[model samples]
Target chain A: MKHLLSASDLTRDDAVSLLDTAAELASVTDRAVKKLPTLRGRTVANLFFEDSTRTRLSFEAAAKRLSADVITFTAKGSSVSKGETLKDTALTLEAMGAQVIVLRHHASGAAQRLAQSGWIEASVINAGDGTHEHPTQALLDAYTLRQHLREGAGDLEGLSVVIVGDILHSRVARSNVALLTTLGARVTLVAPPTLVPVGVQTWPCEVSFDLDEALVGADAVMMLRVQTERMTAAYFPSVHEYSRRYGLDSARAARMPDHAVVLHPGPMNRGMEITAEVADGPRALIVDQVANGVSVRMAVLYHVLSSQEGAP
Target chain B: MSGLANEPAVDRAGEREIVLRDIRLMGDRQAVDIRFADGRIAAIGATAVAEADPQAQILDVAGRIGLPGLVDLHTHLREPGREDAETIETGCQAAALGGYTAVHAMANTQPVADTAGVVEQVWRRGREVGLCDVIPVGAVTIGLSGERLAELAAMAESAARVRVFSDDGICVSDPLLMRRALEYVKAFDGVIAQHAQEPRLTVEAQMNEGALSGELGLTGWPAVAEEAIIARDVLLAEHVRSRLHVCHLSTRGSVEVVRWAKARGIDVTAEVTPHHLMLTEELARSYDPLYKVNPPLRTVDDVHAVREGLADGTIDIVATDHAPHAHEDKDCEWGAGAFGMLGLQTAIGVVAATMVEPGHLTWADVAQRMSVVPARIGRVEGQGRPLAVGEPANMVIIDPDAPWLVSADQMASRSQNTPFVEHTLPASVWATFLRGRPTVLSGALV
Candidate 1:
């Protein structure tokens, strides 16, 4: 793919190929020398307009592992804070001979604009935009899912996935719903009516307000973090109320089918969206998702930058 | 008025008496000849009168359909402020090119038009341009701050004779202020046009609240934000037994509310903009700020609902809400950009495409919605009159079959921020006459 701006931009074949490539790249992490010469002599710039240490570090590690020279520019303590625009920053990066730009912006469509705006010729990858898609996160989640549920099957057809909590503001939920559905997973979103956007009916997944009902036949249950900042504005009544209704506590986690896995795109609220017991439980794959994030990002950078069309 | 340094001086010294021969009047199949002299329609008949006045100019317009000049109840001529975006002269030229003879200048300008002096200056500027009538809409609030009411009585009685009062860019959200404004306008028989967006409900809203917005990650502007305000305002207007006009009704729920209010015998009138009737929130998918507007473009279902509302008379007229902004305002990121688009030049073509072509409204209905009803709402005199003998000769000759693609570079407006650019639209204004003077002749501004 020329760019990874949205998870919806990936087709079934493209998603699977990226997952398989990530699986192959994951092996390098176990080796003494965890470096590949695939992107040697190439440069990838991480242009972050938002504060995202985890995503930025993951991208940096992924590029270094692939042997690509990396440069990171955070919005804070830079020209970005002095009102330099995305265009100016991108043009400056282009002048410095950067071939690929990984962007995590606060605005929803910053990555899309960076790619289509003709400001620079570099391939753009969206790290995470404002409540928008995080394609790499979805890919890593898919990779982690494939490693467990459909190990060596190379596809995730007929798997049922239930995503619960704060679907309205979760970029992870938006990306996972799109990417997982593309891989033939039947996805159901469970959230409070206020936590769901007005037009959730139009999404591909079935929606339910009841978390227990959605957890019954699910192959995987993904818990999204509930931002407490949104709580002050009355998105929900209180943290306690939200936790009581949607939190994946041990009681609700036990209700899931024995083989069903629990996933949380992390920095999880230990007692909020998920209980400490459930989050530390055997079914939880939060740690694995983070580790796979590096491999998946490497695969994306390799595909987008190593291809002849994307190559400078 | 001297502050209008960039205003184009219109030279009307050479305006001549004209005769249009064999022009098809709207809703009539047979062609007729129309003669104009002394700023009035001297004659209109099947055959041209044998006038011996050698100075009269006669043009043979065989197939063009003539309708009363369009009147826009909503237009933003950013004068007395923000002249870099648009001035009264340029905005009038755009209106003339779009077949509009009169437009109510919105109150949301720099130095908000809340007083008699500002409205009079804007009105005089329109008169100086001589392209179209520019009636200044008085701000319902002091500075459109939704605080104290403006000088509605003074503005209504001033030289500008403002008949429509509005706080268009911002809603007069305070219920007491809205009620007082509605009640105060009743003394002068003025209508209070509401912008109808509850601020709290749409704090950081960037686009329509839907699946696309969720996926795109733009802040969702729920339809209830617009509907709830409209619902409350209509009741306020009803309680006071005063006239209320809803500006740019964009959602299906808002339509249902307006329809309900009208059915209850309340004196409420709502207008849908050309953009709301045709464009949808899907256009925001491209992240282009040109599609950004107040009361953000809704879904396809809302577009159809607004169109149906207009067709069924639940909506009274089609207003352009012709907001103009400079390049810097629209060329930035979608969230940082201003909320508006160029509409004065493309209003008629969009109305024709969305309303007339689909059989939702006949050509005669187009005249009523685009001209007569808007004129009535704004209380504009000598404009949007019937194309009959002795009426003021404010009319437009349209070639409905003529199709043209929109190009912002070629538009007369100062700003090239129209979302309709590159869109092939049906209908074209062949000629526009404002009181016997041709402001637009042969589809070009005079």
Candidate 2:
């Protein structure tokens, strides 16, 4: 309730309520005005230590649409590059009266440290952290899943969601597994054996090495972005081999049930994890995931700010 | 309040003889009085008070367990470089409070302790501090670069008489260099305490590689990184017929490898940190950098295996790899934060909690593991000796039943980065005597 740092922090009831709130907020985006007075006097600071233009703009749009003042601080040209620490940056923003901090850092536990450090008074919303949980991304992905599959009414009960590609380094996959499984969806992680994390058998989901075998009965398939850096790390021998084994092409898409949809937490590798045909196909909810991202972020910012009186 | 400058000397030429009353020696059912004079135990019997000089100071420590003063094989004082984190004086104070009479200061300081000059400077600083004997551990390679050999023989012959050499915080990973370092130290009977992490396997490693690290998303510090190096170094040590001491043996596989090496009659000794014996990788779930350490806290099974290893004499000693970092270093993100936590002040309590209280190790076994064996391994004289007549009066009195809450702000170390801040730990050290000099009295630094 104090912060939306991880998907695992959300319970069944909390996730359902947040999703329901996002559903209500989604209608506002369709309106001509698309403005809400709920966070009119509040301030939301988008603190991106890692460059993610799409995610930054999504959060900025969410805050602006809610009528809250938004300020963006990227690590690229700011004091962060000049040897300023995350604590100092966060404190500076809080001093300037930022009530909520949406952080995206390259370090895994940066957001958690900020929240628990007792350094600042702002409520922390983890936009995304290094290979760690992206709670908002998970929420938006869950929102996207509910809209196409369940008509946006209830939890994803009995929904078989199979997540594909680099589960080891994907914050999206980690967050989605936590949130989707929490929402009663049966999740399966499919990756090349090298791409899969060690000690993943303890996760609440099933695992598969074969993309085809995992795709057959899935209700929703989420493709994670496989970075070029992972290739050099020798996680896979080559792009050709990785794509051949785990990439979702037209043939792999045809293996899934007709009702099943594909989702990607983009910026995607067009030819690597997925093909152009499947990404832009009718069953692909990739664009919808982006649009729903703003709604979910608004619900999060509103929830964090409106429910509390002062510093958490 | 200064760790050294402002303190009055506890040991002086005119110091009076002292009589410790009602103290129970290790494995002893009945308590006895121990009288000290001229930096040696004068008597240890029922009639010690009658035999003592009339000017002797009589102190009552009823029912307290008395043992040879603890000696740490590995410690990071952070002095001669980063005094903002810790100095020899404060580190020794913390050591005295933790019941350690002597500590082998690790060689990872800035301007790294690789030469005779640096090691002598560190050794001299410990002498000036006059708290605990700070035996400087010489670096195996020049500046710990893992390439060429350091001035190991010169450091050994220096005033520090450094017998334990290490490239701690950076492994001497090159096998040829490792073999050469291991073989070269044999001349001075020196032991190489290797920081057993394979550098490549732990490039960006943040925590122990397992289910927890997979869940936390911090890069995995796989157990193989530690085990592989230990296995390699032990074989290399056996081949060269040199002594090899594994620093902070963390994983269960590492323990198995050490057991195998010992069974194979390899001249290999291993030491486990106090934090490793108790804390596990589960603490990484909080994402707090306080639990962050090198050879990252392993799983519960690894903990049990190390405990069993220590109990069975496979792990030779309990060393407090008490690495201290400044507040700025640990107050940030887990990955960006510095590795290591304060251990000098909490070693005994952690050992008691994880080993003794659980019935795995006896008080006699504790003396052997924490004090006797560590002194022998480091080749320290006048320490790890019996608390008997004609023996050097290096000893500690521990109240086994007294459990105290750990607070970072109260520690004598310059930095407050202890992971055990709020923990109520067992077995408090009431007093620590270094050669008849009281460095810690009534649980406070003297």
Candidate 3:
């Protein structure tokens, strides 16, 4: 609970408590004055070593709604470009009294290193690291799933979730697989053989190369964005081929159970991994995931910064 | 070869002649007295007590184990280029402290030791330091670019007398170039030491490719990248009938390949690094750059296999691969950091802890793997000699029962990048002698 660096760090109870807190905080968004005084005197620093506007803005909004002062430091305009190290930047942030650091770095384990390096005392929340984990994204996805599938149930005991597309490079896919499995959900990852990592067999979830087969009994299908940059390395022969093999088009979306929801951590590849029609369709909870992102982040900041002890 | 009056009795004017009393030699239960004088073993016998040499420094070593001086066939001095990281002087000091009488300085320096000039420079600097014999390994390709063969014959004929050629940090990935280099070295009785990494497969490899790498999200360095090259090189060595040395073998598959090649009577020798035998890829979970080395630490299963290979003589030797990098090079993020660790000072202790303590190798086997075999592979002379009368008097006394905590500050290497920091290891090198000169005594560099 000290730092939400990886989704795997959360236990079942820890995950449920964050979801419940997020459920309670979701009510504030409906009010005209959607602000809370929970973190009025605290400060959160968004130290992003990578360019991630969406995640940074989401965390900023969440902190603002909780009344915590926020400071934004981007690698492009900061001393990081001048060769100032992560440790020096962290120490500077500590001097500025940053109670929590929300970091998005290009390196896979930057957030973990920042937390464990003893360079600073601030709690670290991994906004997104290089193909590692985005705990908040997974929490928001879980919150969206719980609101739709479980309704009043606190645990997602028997729900089946299928995650499709570039699982090898998707931090969202990695985080979701970990968090969903920990919540008693059966998760299946569907990707092309090349897109799957070397050790996917060892993950808690089952893996499939066929999207249609994975979609059969799934209550939720999450589509991960196809990174075109990775295409240069020829992970797949062509984009058209990838779309044909793993794309969640309308037909494939319809093949799912009637009550199954479709989720995508945006910005979606409209014509690639997911189609425009399926992304905006009635079964799609993509917009709901973004909204839940704010609430989930608010809950995380509350848990890490507040004086409250133990599970909520 | 005793004495002109102008030449000091020891190598240096202030150096002391020492006689060790009642020290137990490795592989022998009986203790004997050893006398060192005039840069050679003056006498060694059951009755040659310290009382015979009244002026010699006398020490009683009851439980210490005596072994031949270790020789490292693989080490990166980082000199002639990255002196801020390590130099010939500092590296030799580190080697001497690690109980090494000699180390093959790798050829991946700034200008690369491709010519006689560079090789002789490294050789002369080692002599100036006078700690351990630093044999400069000539590059197989000029500037380690893997384009053309270096001046191997000139280097072999120079004052350095280099016999081992390697482009260690960069693989001679071209097959024709590798074959030509192997064939070319045959005239001089030279060996080509290969790094054995396929660059195309390990484009941005950060750690071993397995379940742990997938979970950690770091790029996977597949074992096949190393195995494929080894398999090809062993075959090439067999076809050419030349000697080949594999550097820092880190995979179970690589061990099997070497074992199979040896079974086929191929003229090939392989060395396992101390880090590979003692550490694993699980350490990368911390993402500390200290654990990030080239031919990255592998799984526990690979460690077991390599140890078994060494124990059964399938693997010929243990090399330190003592690579040092500056703080800036290793203090950054894992991807940005350099690919090596400080191994010279901790090599013996690690070997003792991983090999001897596990009953995989005895103290005699330690000497052979760390000393005798490596000396033969690198063609190093006057080193790895047995401890007896008229030997070169190059040896070390290890207190096998003593345990000491490793601290980076205590090491002689210029860079403090040892991964063994804070680890308590059994066995300490009590003293080390190079050509009858005591370079280290009472666990401190003389």
For model 1 the interface RMSD, in Å, equals 1.4
Docking class of 2: high
lDDT of 3 by residue, B1-446 (tens): 34321122343545567788888877578888888776667788854563355667888888588898889999999999999999898999899999988989999998889999999999888878888888999999988999989889999999888999999988889999999999999998999999999999998889999999999999999999999999999999999999899999999999999999999999999999999989999999998888999899999999999999999998999998899989877776676778999898888899899989989998999989988889889887777777877777788889888899999898898999999999998989999988777889989999
lDDT of 2 by residue, A93-160 (tens): 99888989999999998899899889987899998999988999999999999999999978999999
Residue A243 CA displacement from its true place in model 1, Å:
2.1
| Models ranked on TM-score | 2, 3, 1
Interface CA RMSD of each prediction in angstroms: 1.4, 0.7, 1.0
How many backbone collisions does model 3 have? 0
Error of 2 at B131 (Å): 1.2
TM-score of chain B of each: 0.96, 0.97, 0.96
Candidate 1 scores an fnat of: 0.54
Find the 10 residues in a row with the least total lDDT in model 2 chain B.
B1-10
Q: Across the candidates, what are chain A's individual TM-scores?
A: 0.97, 0.98, 0.97
lDDT per model vs. reference? 0.88, 0.90, 0.89
Ten residues in a row with the worst lDDT in model 2 chain A?
Answer: A303-312
TM-score, model 2 to reference: 0.96
